[model samples]
Every structure is written in structure tokens, then in C-alpha cells.
Target: MSSDDTHVGLHPDDLDLLERLGRIAAVVDPVPDEVLELGRAAFELHRADALLMSLVADAGAAVRDNGAATASHLVVFELGETSVEVEVARRGEFVRVIGVVMAADQPYAGECRVSLETSASTTTQTLDDGRFAFERVPVGLARLVLDREGDQPMRTPWFDAR
Candidate 1:
């Protein structure tokens, strides 16, 4: 199916699901046919059963909820033979981080770091694409630090507000 074909134009079902998921203003962009094709091929080649299919669907949901299409900015990092792309967004009282990593020409292996810093606190570590989120971040000046170790660490020059 083409991307345009996948666009359902705000159906009732779509609105219901989005509301139930607490995502009212989130935009629902159509998934590309290429992505669906890749998912189907992966399932067929690897013999992924129903459980795996369910997991993939859940992951897709999370990706949608994390504002993949309207991401504020994407941080790209090249670290020791690996390239990582991270999507960042401001969600409610915290900043949501989502990312995918691939070793040059290889399938995504899922490795990256997302750090949020305030004057009083700082945290850092590698995280799965669906896993990194900082909560209760004080409403003040803060910085987002994306570190990939071997690569030059990137800092978002301390912006005010959550």
C-alpha cells in the first residue's frame, strides 16, 4: 500500500484509539509501504510468530506516541563504526527520547545514550529505543546531553523551560 492510501483521514476509530492512549494532539501520519514491506519480510525470513508480531505492534504504538513525525529535533551521532539517530520531544512534564542505532550497513542493534541535565542533577547511560524518559524535570533552564562515547558529545546549550 502507498503512504497516501494508508492515510485514513481522521476516522472515528483512529480518534478513539488516540484519545484512549492520551494522545489528543498527536498527528497520525501514514506508515510508509517500504516499512511495512520490511516488517513483513523480517517476519517471514525469521519465522517470527504471533508473539513477535504483537511486540512489533506495541513498539509501533510507542513510536507513534513519542511524536516520531513531529519530533522537535533529531540528534545524529557517529560513534566507532556505528550511526545512531535519536528523536527528542517535550511531552507533558518531561522530555521523551527515542532512538535507533545501526552499525554501518547492519540492521538496527538498538544502542544509544540520552541524558537530561539540570543545575542540580545529571544522568547518563545507554538505552533501548522505547526505554529512555526523564520525569519530574523541574521547570527551569536545562540541557539535553547526547553522548555516544567515542564521538564528540553534543549538548543543547541550556534552554530555559522544561
Candidate 2:
């Protein structure tokens, strides 16, 4: 090892500059609390019993009460062989969730049971051609559950719909 290349500590001037940068960034680019929580939840994605799917896309929040076209959220979840796409819409005080399954490579197991798991309530529906919908759902953190035959049920991550 070269003695010239050895550095034991950060320079005082560099430390001062880093501190100033941090202060500036804290004001200009603060991280949201939800983002931090989502990042923490991402760490549990690979758990053995739970099948976690990544969000492929999202449609930003819509303006409230635009006639019958209420605010809606569309999201897609992707795993290796199975992918699910869902549309969540606000139905006055309640919610409506519509979902479709996209199976990759192998043949699908015909049908699966779909459920909406919310902190306030949980609702179930039967899938027809991998399509299901739930009406009059309550708001809160909810996930889509897919119960399969001879296999562990798949659940989408808890999504907060406030």
C-alpha cells in the first residue's frame, strides 16, 4: 500500500461542504413519509410464504367528483409467472376495485378466488377468466388476494387509498 494514497479521515473543509449540502437538500428535496414506508415494505418482498409483486405502473390521482367519473387508480403487479392488473375507483363514500390476471408461460389453473383485504373490511369475489370486481368497498389499506388451488394464495401489497 502506498502511504500517499492512505487517508484516515475526511477533511474538515469537505465535512463542512457536506453538511451544507445536506441542509440545502433537506429543504429542497425532502423525502415523503409514505415513500420511506414503501421502501421499508419493499424489503419484505422476497419472503418465502408471501408472493410479492412489483408495481409496474400507476395513474396519478384524479380530481374529486368529476361527475360519474370519480377519482380512480390503476396499478399493475408483476411476479415471475403471474401478473395482475387492477383499477380502483372511488364510488362516493365507498370504493370499487376491478382486476384481471395475466398468467405467463404456463396454462392458468382455470379460476381463482379474489378478495379485497382492507383494514376496515375484507371482501371476496370469484374470478371469471381471471377477472373480478368488488363494489361498495371501504377506504384504507387494501390488497388483492388470489386464492389458488393446491398453492399458496397470492396477495398484492397493502395499498393505502385515502
Evaluated with TM-score, which candidate comes out highest? 2
Consecutive 10-residue window with the lowest summed lDDT within model 1: 50-59
* lDDT of every predicted structure (CA atoms): 0.48, 0.72
Worst 10 residues of 2 by lDDT: 1-10
Residue-wise lDDT of candidate 2 within 1-162, one digit each (tens)?
Answer: 111223348676766787688889988998998997886576445333756677788774776574565788888887778888888888666677887887884334476787777654567777887788887777666777778877687878877554
Clashing residue pairs, candidate 1?
none
In angstroms, give how far residue 74 of model 2 lies from its true place. Answer: 0.5
Q: Evaluated with lDDT, which candidate comes out highest? A: 2
Residue 69, candidate 1: how far off, in angstroms?
24
- For all predictions, the C-alpha RMSD in Å is 17.5, 16.2
Candidate 2 ranges beyond 4 A from true positions = 1-48, 61-69, 105-109
Off by over 4 Å in 1: 1-110
